[model samples]
Target chain A: MAVYTHLGAEDLASLIATYDVGELVSAKGIAEGVSNSNWLIETTGADGAGARFILTMYERRIELDDLPFFLGLLDHLSAHGAPVPRTIHCRDGDAYQLIDGKAVALIEFLPGVSVDQPTPAQARAVGAALAEMHRAAHDFPMERANTLDIGESLRVLQHCGGNALATVDPALPEMIDHAARLSAAWPQGLPQAVCHTDLFPDNVLMRGSSVTGMIDFYFACTDAMAYDIAVTHAAWSFDKSGGRFDRAIGRALLAGYESVRPLDPVERQSLPVLAQGACLRFVASRAEDWLETPVDALVTRKDPMDYVRRLHFYAEAGDNPFHPAAD
Target chain B: MAVYTHLGAEDLASLIATYDVGELVSAKGIAEGVSNSNWLIETTGADGAGARFILTMYERRIELDDLPFFLGLLDHLSAHGAPVPRTIHCRDGDAYQLIDGKAVALIEFLPGVSVDQPTPAQARAVGAALAEMHRAAHDFPMERANTLDIGESLRVLQHCGGNALATVDPALPEMIDHAARLSAAWPQGLPQAVCHTDLFPDNVLMRGSSVTGMIDFYFACTDAMAYDIAVTHAAWSFDKSGGRFDRAIGRALLAGYESVRPLDPVERQSLPVLAQGACLRFVASRAEDWLETPVDALVTRKDPMDYVRRLHFYAEAGDNPFHPAAD
Candidate 1:
């Protein structure tokens, strides 16, 4: 949402020299990635002006140990020909290094605009891309378990329950409690795969109707394949306010995903509960964020109510997992 | 310093069509200007990828009337062969238009890095650019009086006088009072010209030893040409923490200005007072900004004490205006 750290030209130039990249011409702190400081850097090589690349300095929210997993996953996906950014290694072959006491890396800049209110075709493209990414990352050696599983969701819910939220609208806690209960009883034994846990519309880049790149792999982890599909459905099927679910977008998305890799009967049957769980996870995290984030900090705190409405939508779908959208 | 607005692709693409710029490929909100929302837009022309341009949406701080003068001054200087960006007019010949209730315009994106801790050569380049801008803007039809004059400084002082700032240090008021007195006694009627009042290092871009462009003309106004030089000197000479003023940088800047248009005898003699006035202006504005800006707003409110230190430096110079530095 904002560039938390300011990098001077001299400091940036010296840092860029650690890579085999060309002479640094300029770097502009672009407002894209929220958890890290992202600068769009331009350099000049023997051929004159070179291509642009993103120089990212991982911020506080990202753990240092988890970086290798994310970077390796990007490399693995890229090597397998998925439309994902390849992390550019340093002169010493390390993909990232500490600069000014923060883990920093340069990645090949993906050229495309992100569609927020995506069209059906764009949603379909994103669905296919997500499937491609999941397929490509299947054999990625470095594995990290999902951090925001039901366990973490329950933890956050308890944390939120202690706060003043428990006082205002008692039904809020009741709803989250009911969703957690449903998630606890839900079917889990689906094909396990590496999934982009945070596949929001803003994270997917598109050029016209084609998906050019998928970014922000910090949240990537090994999770249930159906759960990943459910998350993607939650992201793509909702409006900006995150209230009304668009069936056309959900239909196109599911069709596109199935076009690449067909879902098993058990996975398909778990869609409604999986979607509810996904929505519940977001609601819990966002509620925590809304309560915890410092008002002075320069980050946009997403409304927890968006996911609340999503949970309501999924609850209405009941046991008819595929329902009006995916069917 | 931060991008306040987020525009979707569809809205931006429609906006791009109003101009002759090619198909919009992407628009990244580059964190540069604090007063306005700026996006670095890339497009693809008939011959493949086109050049990058800056799209600015004037925010609350900038006055509506002053835009024409600022835009026209850029046009004037650009036409006079100065290395400044020309305001790109719309298809209907309007330089700007209201979009989503905000005044928006496109300008050619200037390529270069901004040097905060400037070397002597970079100081010279910035000084030369400032002089060239003043010379080029002399005949510009639009005229904007200096907003932060001695009177304005007095006004801000009185305003700050009302706040709890007066209770912190009694000496605070005295220092500002003395600086205001010095400013009040500044020489009058000394070669009035269109001056880039806020010609800080951040406003001037450089590549190697050469200045690629001068930008952010929202503060440009007709004032004592020597006053502008004084402002530029304050920018080029100071360190980041704003304690020590570099003599070498000041010498190079003055020399560079003289190469373009030599300062008159009166202008040369009036340096110390004008420098004090410039310092006072920043002190007053920064004081107001510090007191007024909400802690939540994504703006870097510069410490007023920095200019307070500069005021002390100028006060020590007394009548020996060209002591150790400008001479």
Candidate 2:
């Protein structure tokens, strides 16, 4: 839970005036994501109607230049009817602008609850939403290379080993080697499209097993769409501890994804390695956060061992449960 | 900003079932206050109506037995049309219950914006609301003693002297001495009532110049009504640095309070000492928090010296601003 930036009422009122959105009624910081400061803002429309929105102030971690891709992707996907927030345009015909020296954007508030441990049905709904977002953003004009690609993952893993990771878990070095091997030999991609790179369970909102929306598109980039499926599977099919895999939920999520856009034979065959890469991505990121983040930071870093165990599960499995046969 | 207790969706759903509120739609952890975990909960009502409520999970600092007094005071005040959140009772007729080993309660969501540095008009509105609440809660059946009374203040002052407070500011001891003197010489009986002991700027919500609500009554207790005014005066009439007092706002606040219930001569005479006591309470508590809170806590510990400076200003002033003739 974080709200890194604080804005005063007068500053907020002036910021609101720069947009077509009406008078600011209230803005309360929401402690959800770790990447940026988010506030739930309410305004009275010029027509005297009421509206609610989410005002995001990009923090230090996010690259300012990359915001256009994130905002444009949301704009493109929402226009295509995907379950995502629609960016509210500013008076200057841009969805993103500067407020108090930080890049700020407003998006319509999406209504739905994010669960810690989703039921199998809810897992499938999330899978369906990811697929929907992937399809919707396929033709998005912007492109951003994944910052934490295989090479970056290797760097993070090395950093973790040199730092305090071994003290936390002695198996980290060996796990890094295994992940490096899989990432180095990653299969040739069969399908590429816009993808939500970090579709964690908390990013998908559900209402009674129905997908309401997908949020936190900061990591969205042009990547192998099948890799997105693998990431979402890792997100939804894994238990909270990530030590155990739920095959039933994995199959359900795959089925949900297939309902929208079926995986081609090559894509299906690459699921295991892709899943390994996804696990490695999280493992390295979590390790870095655990080692690098200041003790005084208001962030709760996930245990890297959780992803370490998940990577092991992926390594031990000869074939993906969702795609049993190589194509 | 705190969300100390994390509740899973299944637990939340079951908890909602115990109430007639409705189907759970969403629950976002609100990053606002430092004392408790707060979630902005939305539900589709049992009758298919939509509603939003605040779900507060009481943290360790709060006493469980004192919850009845706090919740009952809100209930009583809101029932009498004072601007405060009404506690929502569960189907079992209890307003307080436990979820995930943490005591929790749901209250109706009041709509208004809370500001950091309130305008003079806004400060007056807040003062009016505080006065209204005091009048309405006068006959409240339950009573809790002010935990930060003169004796407690002296103890906290002593604790501050022995801690790292000197490292933060060398003048702390002198300020502590001054505060101790005022607290030890607190005036004898004036008007007493159930008071909202902490009426900080962030605790009051405003729409334009009108106060929409008063919140965070965890500190409410049986105390001198004049002391409550003094506490609020300290909260609203002082700048963040606490070095300079805004006399116009202070006068406006006193006028607003007098509009609802006039201050007796005895109460008026007690204002200076009471205000001094209020400053001391915040100074000691903030010092304790600064010394004890973990470095990684999500909370921002207020500088104790801000209150110390305010205590100094209160000490040096020959006349109470509220009582022009008194030194």
Candidate 3:
């Protein structure tokens, strides 16, 4: 959401020189991602001109050991013909470079904008891309746990306590109780794969309802594929604050997912509890961030109550939206 | 330093539509300017493709009525063959458009980077560009009073008082007395023009030793052109935090300015006080910002002590840097 690191034009040009990309023309800091800084880099190509890429500086919430996996996953996925951008290795074949003790990498810049009010067509394209990413990540020769899962969510939520939740909203403290119920009902032994756990609308880049790129893989990890669908459903099927649900977008997203990778009957039935867990996961994290984030962080703190509304909807309705009632 | 507004992709594409530039391909938020949100916009050119522009959304510290003067100054200078960007008017010929009750405009994107550690040649180029801008701005219809002048600086510094200055540096309070002396000695009426009062290294975009454009005109107003030189000298001739002075860069900058338009003998003699006034101007504002800027502001609170050190340097030896001492 903001550029935290201030790299000079010389440092950037030298870093770009590490690769085969010609001289740096311009680098503009992009307003994207919460935990890292990104720049849209334009350069003179090796032979011609106007080659563009994304330069990212890893800032926080990621460790040195995780760099290989994160950068490697892109190489693997893009190798499998997914629309994900490839991590451009340095001339020495290293995945990332260290500058002032921080890791930075150049990535292929995939064109298209992340939608705000995603149409049914856009939602469908994103669903299809998510499924494709899951398939493409099949042989990605590495593993990282879904660290921000239900257990992590509950831990963070409990830390918020009743007093802090009261500051955000009166009803937020009640999510602690509801989270416990979801934790108990949370299933095991369903279909699983390397899932893009945070595939919100903001992550999927689209051009006229055609999915061009799925980006920001810092939160990506090995997890239940069905749970990934649940996260996407909870994310894209509602208005920004989760106040209103769009059934068409929901059905289109689900159908698009099924068209590529059909869900098992168990996966279908589990959607009810999974969506609730997805919504609760947000409730816990948003509440923690609301309490703990510094006032001046470039991030916009999301209201925990937004997910609270979604959790209530999932709790009461179950899988009604998936069936797609005729309008 | 950070993007304050979040414009949707649809809103931005439509905004681009207002101009004859093609459809919006991408808009990357640039970390430029303290009080405005700027995006480096790339469009599919109306005839060809890949035309670039800068989209600016004014956020704070600038009034709506002042926009015409600011935007029109760029138009006036560029039309007169100064190395400045031209304002791209909307289809209805409006200089700026209102979106969500905020003003935004498109300007030609100039190529080159704002230098970090500027070389003497680079400083010289910026000096020439500044002088050219001052001359090109002649006969600009609109007039804006230099609001943040010596009087305003004194007012802000006085408000900070001893306690606030102590927080920044114990010596900062002593600047108030020095500012008063400079205020009393401040000479009246030197040669005046539309001055780009902020010609810092960061404001002048350069390709090697050549200046591509002079930018960030929000501070432009009808004022003493020599005072503008004083401001630029103070800004570019010192290192960041004002710890050390670069004599070659300082001499080159002044020489470059004289090459364009030689200073009046009266203006040359007034350099000492005008330069001290320039130093005090920043010390006052930075101290006020250091005291009052909110904790969560995306801006990094600059050390007022930086400018205080510069004030001391100018006070101890007036205008010596402008005249080169043989090595």
Candidate 4:
């Protein structure tokens, strides 16, 4: 609620007229997303006579610098025949426009409902789609985004040690400190690739039992490809209790990913530790955020132990046993 | 940063003369906390001769109704000679004041530095202090707070099922549903007592290896004592990788607590599920908050899986193994 983008009816109608494929029919705000202002635009045109698209006003509250990359990435993927949304170019031949101080983009709206919990088949399809996207964009040029590096992650975990140990549990600091040291000692020198930094289940769309498309590339950036795989594994492998990783699902996902683009031995070797690093990063942030929560916002209590346990899981496992398909 | 509370040097001197304290030699803001503005007031007066106190402007963001209960609880504990800051009675012997649209209070500041991590002895001391505080407040009268009972918790988990199952692991929703069902079936007849809702490590202060004081009682309210223990256990027992619970630390904490105040049989029986419930509550809140993070905060990504594993741990454990020392 800190920032918002609003589009008036007249502006939306005028904007819709510029698109060659559709006649301006109706536009209404979609209430789904919390981030950007989305309008479901209905168009009647000679091509299909009737088609639906989403007109989005980029929320200034989120990083605006990454907008071009996300939109361009989708455009590139669509051009390569990937089952992704096609960015609707404006009359000026631009994929996006600056309107009313917000970045505005129109994309062909794919028909599907977001599934809360996807079955193994759905997860597998997502894994496959992600692999394909990674392969297709392997050479795509983009600057690195997130500021965090391995050293920064290590520093966060190290900082938590003092706070963790000083409480009712005296042993947590040493354990976190040890994990930080171990993760720091992990071997480096892997090739970096474009990664969908935020690949939570909600970001992927499912049609029937299969993933039809992937969305939300706002966090996508140039990073270690294995780290993305690690993120995918972490996202997909945990059971509801979140206590243990599901080996079957892990295998299914890895198999699906390898079917499209296989991971090298070094990438495979670094995964478990990368996952641990991911866990540590989240824990440290949550811990710090917990301390900073306004006394009035007492409803928000950061659960530091979640990442703590996840870090432990990666440490104990040493390496992920599931292998990507041997292309 | 939004509100300023300090008076000018001349104004502060004039204000000091009206109070019982002889003279305020020095006063400065404590910049550590993100909430309430705090000033370390050094005063020389006939009553205490030379004493230092912390004057705090209670943040309006916190529930104003609950402020009296927290102030009373602190006053009651200090009066009982507990190792807590003593609230200083104002000119009219009141413990609080309305200053510049905010609640303000002054308390004799306990001498100690906030330690990052405490040794085993420090943890034990905190455990003992918490137990003693609980025992002392057993008969203190207060209205019940946080009406979202056990049933509400079950409802949230059930509602989150679709979202939980649709991600990487389909089993997570099943586990949450199972825990919810099991928790629903369990008997609930535990006695209620005053509980410190937020007892994380940083909230406790230490002088060397000894815990000198506990602060931040904004969430203190009447709740099940076993729930408080569960909160403590969850806070204290996690190992470094954050994947496993440190049974040794758990045992030590329980032993330390029981040395001062013992848990009833029924209370002991309910601890595990309560701990699971605590885990569930945090996970649910975090998951909801994850959807709300400003797209721009690019500062951190909140991982929901961390809590899933914790809930699984308590569910697998089945029952709390904690026992108090023989008095």
Q: Pick the candidate with the highest DockQ.
A: 2
True lDDT of residue A157, candidate 3: 80
- Could you tell me which residue pairs clash in candidate 1? none
* Per-residue lDDT of candidate 4, residues B1-327 (tens digit): 112454444445555565677666545444334367666666776476666667778775566777778788888776766676767777887777776678777777764434333445655777787887787777667654854445655666566666744463454566467556756765466777777866766566555456567777766778887787787777667742237766666777776777788777888888877887776666655555555555454224445556667667877776644644321
What is the Cα-based lDDT of residue B288 in candidate 4?
Answer: 53
DockQ of 4: 0.01
Clashes of 2: 1
- Residue-level lDDT tens digits of model 3 in A1-327: 678988887788788889998888767778786788898888887776568899999998989899999999999999998889999998999999899999998999987777788888888888889889999998777999988888877878888888888888989888888878778878899877788888987787777888888898998889889899999999999997788999989999988888898888898889888898999888888888788878666557888889999888988887787664534
For each candidate, the alpha-carbon lDDT, in order, equals: 0.82, 0.82, 0.85, 0.65
Computed on C-alphas against the true complex, the DockQ of each candidate is 0.62, 0.63, 0.56, 0.01
| Candidate 2 ranges with C-alpha deviation above 4 Å | A162-164, A294-299, A324-327, B294-299, B324-327
Q: Model 2 - which docking category?
A: medium
Q: Provide the fnat value for model 2, as a fraction from 0 to 1.
A: 0.77
Question: In candidate 1, what are the lDDT values of residues B1-327, reduced to their tens digit?
Answer: 677788888888888889887788878898888789899888885367576889999988789888888888888999998899999988899889998889999998887888767888887877788788888888888788888887788778777884445653445577556756776687888998898888887788788889888989888888999999988887678786569978888888888888898887888888888888888888778777777777766567787788878878877866453543435
Residue ranges of candidate 4 with Cα displaced over 4 Å? A1-3, A21-28, A31-35, A45-48, A61-63, A152-183, A284-304, A320-327, B1-327
Model 4: per-residue Cα lDDT at residue B253: 70
lDDT of 2 by residue, A1-327 (tens): 688777876677788888877788877789877778888888887576878889998887888988888888888999999999989888889888887678999888988887877777887777788788888887888888888777678888877674366766787777667767876788875678888888887788778898888999888878899888888888878887887888878887887888888888888878888888888888888888778777676667788888877777877784757663322
What lDDT score goes with residue A171 in model 4?
A: 42
- Stretches > 4 Å off in candidate 1: A166-170, A294-300, A319-327, B167-170, B293-300, B319-327
For candidate 1, give the DockQ: 0.62
lDDT of 2 by residue, B238-266 (tens): 88989889887888888889889899988
